[model samples]
Target: MAETIQLVFYIILFNFLLLVVTDVSAGGKMTQPKCHRNSDCPRNLCWPPLVAICDLHKCFCRPQHVNLVVRD
Candidate 1:
């Protein structure tokens, strides 16, 4: 009975560690906001290297590259 309990505990721990590793490996992307317009997203909220863009009703920050590909 004690061995069975220990095995269950180890399984649970392994699952938890697996989830953490997956999250870390995925780079833990930042959460974006749902928006209908560009005005809904504010520039101040975006980080320095990233700019807020509203595309397909989602507002998220993307890397700034001379504003060539996408405009604000």
Candidate 2:
């Protein structure tokens, strides 16, 4: 009974480690965006003025900017 418990614990630990390593590897390959301002964004990707976050040489508008809307 004790051996069975030990085996189960090791299996869980191994799976947890595997998941962590996979996540880290995948994150290294993700692509982000780049823009100094809304105007710098191309027509197809332009939204509006907002803070930007840089990741993996890409820039994306901050989450708070999602709530903003342009009125013309």
Winning model by TM-score: 1
Q: Candidate 2 — worst ten consecutive residues by lDDT sum?
A: 43-52
TM-score of each: 0.41, 0.38
CA displacement after TM-score superposition, residue 10 of candidate 1 (Å): 35
Task: Put down candidate 2 lDDT per residue, 19-42, tens digits, no spaces.
Answer: 554334334322234645444433
Candidate that would win on lDDT: 1
Every model's Cα RMSD, please?
10.8, 11.1
* Candidate 1 residue spans exceeding 4 A from truth: 1-29, 66-72
Q: Against the true structure, candidate 1 has what lDDT?
A: 0.60
Error of 2 at 47 (Å): 34
lDDT of 1 by residue, 1-72 (tens): 999999999999997875554344324444356776656766664655656666777665555563333424
